[model samples]
Target: MSILGSYLRLSAADLARAVEQPGWAEEFRDEQTEREELRAPSERRLHETGPAWDELAVLLGRCDLPADLVHGDRPLPGAEDWGYGPPRLLMPEQVAAVERRLADLPFDVLAAGLDPAELGDDDPHALDHLAAEYAALRTFLARTARYRHGLLVRYA
Candidate 1:
């Protein structure tokens, strides 16, 4: 199964609370579970850990981006639920740092660095689709950062 990821926005107050109480983000996860949905209206399903995510991570890593921020399999400090156990807190500063790094990512460089094999062979336009999705994710990250919101990334 493909591993999907979504980003939820957290208010400043919420961030503060989360810092104080690591389980604070669990409420959002519980709400989502109660609704029988993996994502809520306020959250954005940004990318999956396959071709698009993996290729982007590889290219970004080559650019000297922090491995923790770009690597798809990197363990999230405060992530929880979905069989991983209770939710943990994520600091606002950590999210902000990631947002800043994402903002400076060179899309052109990523595209140039991507290996054709990463896109799969069946779909001739896989690269184009990946690029478009990556652009949308970049925009989403910018918007989230502009609002001073912390991202709660959920993986499943």
Candidate 2:
């Protein structure tokens, strides 16, 4: 099965409620369903515990960011009811910190050191594909920070 990553943007108040009330996420999901606003932007997909996801997790680990930000293949706390897993909540500050780390990352430098062959594909663009996904993640985190919104991310 393929594991996908996605995020939801939530207001501070809602985020607080989610932290305070374990059941808030269920209610939020239901309300979103009622309002017909449940769609989340598609992020990326990989094997739940596969190399591609592991590689990204390793790189993120090197950056010394919060563990929750790049948690791999695990359901977040309280996300089980959503039928995926628990979602990782990135507060505005956490988003800003992650964005800063992403901005400082030298993609070309990292790419140069990566062996595409080890990525398990002969496709010449495997590194590019990973880079694009990383960029997308950065953009999402940055947007969440800029808007003072919390980010709810999950791998499912």
Candidate 3:
């Protein structure tokens, strides 16, 4: 859970840094110290701390955690159905709503939560006929067999 929390904050910081200098983001560039010191966001870059906090709330809400405690000060509702993508802008009220939902749930639940569909375990063989070829299916079956064996070894 701590790891997840730290990752969320780090992700927010990375976003802020990317916004400040989209180019220097991938590579270090010096800006100060009479020589371009690797251009990194200053501590002040955390000015968007509120937004960062809000992002966590949105994540918690999306995960279906209770959020009433963290965001009681704000009036937004918990987020729902956020899909796989980069972070999007969120209103402060929305952040508050997410906070409220998170506050009400166990931290582990919030940290581990994600839409179950995102964790699909559907058999690839279910659509084997659509492949128009057996080569792909053969490879899939081979991989699946190996995976199943691995599971058996670990669990049974």
Candidate 4:
């Protein structure tokens, strides 16, 4: 029913008739069917992994907000230009670093272990949280790093 399914079906049909042998045609069709089945899910999973990592990064940051500013919105001083808002912002590089630090950790530990609520609202708290997250994020950076590696690998 899918485009790929149709393409494989057509290809298999052509391969079968081309040789004028019913058995060979059937074999060709079967192999194409299996190959197509494997390709689709592999591509889909690769596509889904990117957004999953982004979502995971966000969840990690939210669960670990600064401890001091545990209450309301107060400008985090010099971060106005940084777009990080009242709470300190996490940079892309820093996020990757945190994933690496926390990669070996079990998912639950990374998810629930670090309490952002413990951080202070002051500059010190923001800086400390950034440092910790940067460290921890390194652990989980494998997936994204692989995606990046693949792109460069293709050219090489």
Candidate 5:
């Protein structure tokens, strides 16, 4: 009944190991649980988009983002469907590309370019969550790109 967007940071070695597991999605779940226990929940790795993932997807689509940056383009081999489908993985190179694209498209420009009504919202702060999430996403990508780390994306 509830859906949320989240991601897991992976090293290339871990990524290679992840693909070998038939239940990598569940494994990632456990990993997130462990991470939460170890560190305070972070907005950097967890998207607060909740059920508005579709809207954010549409808005990013309009912005001409990399097909895999938000929702991911490459499907993980053993990832199982958890409502929105299996988690997708973005390579380190893709992360860098997304970062570059985000740098080119400023948040102000993105907000100015899209209308709230088009995204099916009318609140005065219609883009507030989107802005916050986008900022988090930008920071996340920047960090990953700088470190050349891969990202595993999921919606559940």
Candidate 6:
């Protein structure tokens, strides 16, 4: 089974609701990805970053970026394991903090530390693809901060 990373932008209001009723975040993801039929996925923005996210997260930790940005500060209150466990919820503040950290960090230099052997897929271009996803994720978080939105990160 291939592990994949997914992210969904949540308005402040939606983030509040998700925190109050954690299960809502999963339902929201199902709705968004399904509604889009995943058409124009790039336009869907950072909706999915593939499995490279796992390795990327490790790299982030090595760079001293807070682990909560990807692994999350806490898991949503829910019983659903779904193979990869419950989704991670990052509040608007957490999102902003991550964006701020990304500001000075030359992500490419950090990304170079990623170990090819640790990648989920054996594709030779995995690192390059991960790099692109990293750039997109940074942009996505920046946009999320612009609107003061939070994020829901899920893996499956």
lDDT (10s digit) by residue, model 3, range 1-156: 111110111134443554465443323211322232343432111111122233334443445532231132221123221222222332233344444443454434443544333323244442232222223222322332332211000000
lDDT of 2 by residue, 1-156 (tens): 756655666678877787777577656754653554344443221112333554566456555664356652233355554535576666767767777777777667556667877656688887787777667666766666677776666555
Residue-level lDDT of model 6, residues 31-72, one tens digit each, is: 787777655643452467777678777667766665477766
lDDT of 4: 0.32
TM-score of each: 0.63, 0.68, 0.23, 0.24, 0.84, 0.81
User: What is the C-alpha local distance difference test score of candidate 2?
Assistant: 0.61
Whole-model Cα lDDT of every candidate shown, in order: 0.54, 0.61, 0.28, 0.32, 0.73, 0.74
Better of 2 and 4 by TM-score: 2
- Compared with the true structure, the alpha-carbon lDDT of candidate 1 equals 0.54
Model 3 regions more than 4 Å off: 1-87, 108-156
Superposed Cα deviation of residue 93, candidate 2 (Å): 1.8
Clash number by candidate, in order: 0, 3, 12, 25, 0, 0
Query: Which residue pairs clash within candidate 2?
Result: 76-86, 79-85, 79-86
Worst 10 residues of 4 by lDDT: 147-156
- Give, for candidate 1, the lowest lDDT window spanning 10 residues: 66-75
Model 5, span 22-124: residue lDDT tens:
4764666566656665664332344435667766676677676664676887888967785589888898888888789888876778778687788787886
Clashing residue pairs in candidate 1 are: none
- Whichever of 1 and 2 has more TM-score, that candidate is 2
Worst 10 residues of 2 by lDDT: 42-51
Model 4 per-residue lDDT tens digits across residues 1-156: 111001111222342242354344335434754565467442311121211222334444554432211111232233222211222222234334444544555545544544444432344354344445444333223443433311100000
Question: Which regions in candidate 1 have their CA more than 4 angstroms from the true location?
Answer: 19-24, 29-52, 70-80, 83-90, 119-122
Stretch of 10 with least lDDT, candidate 6: 38-47
Q: In model 3, where is the ten-residue run with the lowest total lDDT?
A: 147-156
Q: Which candidate ranks first by lDDT, i.e. highest?
A: 6
